[model samples]
Target: MHRTASIGLAAACLAAAGVAQTASATAPETPATYLERIAAIDDAGPAIHAVVAIAPDPAGGAQGGAQGGAQGGGPLAGRAVLVKDNIETRDMPTTAGSLALKDNATGRDAPLVARLRAAGAVILGKTNLSEWANFRGDRSSSGWSAVGGQTRNPHALDRSPCGSSSGSGAAVAAGMAWAAIGTETDGSITCPASVAGVVGFKPTVGLVSRTYIVPISASQDTAGPMTTSVADAAMLLTAMAGTDPADPATAEAGRHAVDFAAALSGASLRGVRVGVLRGQAGTTPALTAVFDKALADMKAAGAEIVDVAFKPEARMGEAEYAVLLHEFRKGIDAYLAGLPGQPPARDLAGLIAFNKAHADAELRWYGQEIFEQALAATDEAVYRKARQDARRLAGTEGIDALLARHEVDVLVAPTTSPAWPIDPLLGDHFLDIGAGSLAAIAGYPHLTVPMGAAEGLPVGLSFIAGRWDDAKVLRVGAAYETVRSARLAPPSLRRWGE
Candidate 1:
């Protein structure tokens, strides 16, 4: 029996619930219905604009069927997932939000994609993302992309969706897909997940492969799951976690490759000592109130909460950016060189020139200031000291020190303030970039789950743990999710006025 035969019924049902309730639990929707609801919510109506391309189901026959989608019945089974454009999908072009690479499809699944496919996951489509993952310009908008345009937050259409995982976050929040894959290098994954009020987990650096994904900093880049719930994130991560010989980052992944979702104990926090970093919670009264209630809930759940102090590294900003500029140059060159088909821009220099040639579309809103910087700092001499300093400060003198000092299981903080208004001219005005950066620079595991709503927008509580402690963070997040239960189907129709 084809579940898609009920497409009209699903569409008519969704009309009443609106796009907000796209993740229908009462009725099983067909692939056709998913496409319809996605178009209705993404390209029209609330116009979330989360997806770039909707690929026909690879497992389903030419005519879509619901029995078994691309992801056959396993962990993900018939579940559909939207991948960040940077993560290459053989069936669709991986543009990474840049028109310059519009023909960059390599006809080969990224190792992670292959893993998910083997585990029975349907590659539904590619989601929009920040142009160059928000590394192109100094004053860049988070979700504005040349190929997919700007993705709007479902919580409030006018607010920012925080990049470079902007579309992944929005797609899951808006229920455009069951889940989505997002890459993080700094605030790319968790920040957007926090802003969009979804569960986004950045595994410890080597827990997943990075081969075939667009480059940022090899030091920090890793693909993770952006989903509506922690359980979904865990399920996606298990499929994604493994070793890939092509990418050396996954050398240690096999050791941690476990059924992350099944391993989630979700036990009460009876003796868990959660170190609270109140400093990371910026002076947002609305967010504070919600976080305070969360703390009370944790206490009620039998958690031992304690305050922990972590001073910001004074030179981390300069050193980290320097390392990214350096690694991005080297990493991108290697990625472009390996493309199966010749891309429009074969090199970073070619990409820069191409952007200039098509400035009207690609460079209309922002200039590639970061690109220029990366180009200049490509030499190892310029980046060596910065990379060393960044690692030591973020690791030895950063997260490691805090964890040992506080004698805590993991560190917790507000993922970020509520989503700010999207501004094309002035760009993102986010000020609390510390929490995610702490783990990003340290190459540690970070997970963000919905804490509650701030004003009318969403807020997320972040959990950060030591390197390779991916399961720990996920377990803690699962426990928190149990207590808060703050998540809700996105009401895409709720548009907020500035």
Candidate 2:
């Protein structure tokens, strides 16, 4: 009865938002025009290098169908979406931003890609990402990749575009695509999206399928949307959410197919209690100032804010790393071994060897210590125990406890610190201030919307909710976004400090 009432109330809110769940038509632009615009920004102006490869139209031509097909096929019909390299597309190489799988053209789209196609979306192309999704080396940079080079921030050419979904976030921010698909293992999706001045959403773990995606932690990995607006993210997510027979994680996915964006309209924060997260922000004046303004806006919108203390398992990080190491080998090996075409390396050991052989290119900057550790791991008991312990800390003891104790529907925090300068020699020296781990390790849905900028770079405010409460979470964020619609365009990278 409680769940039913909540659903009904949410439906009423959506009807009041003005637009229907379906997207309205806009003046159609040529796919070529989009590509030209993207190339001008990414390849020519400041060399953003966001897009790794532009996929050919399914019709075997450069120009994709831009017209909304007869009857307006689907909400995303005729939309051009950029997918991260790690997510498979039948036509393009799924490199995961690595030199090893440069020829990994599987000719088999992942389940999510099929859903996008069924919804009439044009698969624009693959975007660059951190090599092996930033799990290869401890010293590796966020946007640096041997396959597609470095992806520079659109806000500042020298700024870091946080990864491993670096190119997905950067490309969407630069108008390369209407939206993009990005997979997250921990902070991969939200971090890049927040720092890039875009909207990023990580759905509940089982809300989407993970088949054919390059994996890090099976316990945490899920692909979500990176877009300029919460509406766009919601639309993309709606198309991508469904159950996959191949992935057991999504057995309950169909039960979560609510219209995420509809709840965004006329949404109010009034009478809603939000727990202010306790971690990694409020230390720096710039970040704190921006966050304080966001809080003020929420309060002005009538939200009751309360401070809460959350002590995540002291050893959660250690356990998460251990689980990932063991699971990466299990997951990556299965994915590689099953590919139709022969990839450069079929296993972790071979991939490591290929890196050594191509040292001038792949290994020029950093060693694959993480890969080595994963390859050497043999303790199944340790992996299972770590997964259990981390899930408990991140779930029941972390996000759940806070909400229950504080009596808040959602939690808020500074998504991350402002973008840091991109340093090639030392790699990413980030502020490590995001509250992503709580939702990430818990397999809960997390949303990051633009808060404001700090030092010419953007920061975001995050909304964290209980598992499978994605619609409510989106509504909460939409309510905040209603008051603070600060989603801005990307920066002209050539002129940074002038």
Q: Best candidate per TM-score, number?
A: 1
Output the lDDT of residue 330, model 2.
83
Q: Which tens-of-lDDT digit does each residue in 379-455 have in candidate 1?
A: 77768889899989888888898889989998999988888988998888987534778899989999998887878
Candidate 2 is scored at a TM of: 0.92
lDDT of 2: 0.80
Tell me the spans in candidate 1 whose CA falls farther than 4 Å from its real position: 1-29, 57-73, 485-489
Scored by CA lDDT, what does every candidate get? 0.80, 0.80
**For residues 103-160, could you state the per-residue lDDT of candidate 2 as single tens digits?**
8888889999888877778888888999999999877888888888989887777888
Check candidate 2 and list the clashing pairs: none
Clashing pairs in 1: 71-120, 71-121, 72-120
What TM-score goes with each of the models? 0.93, 0.92
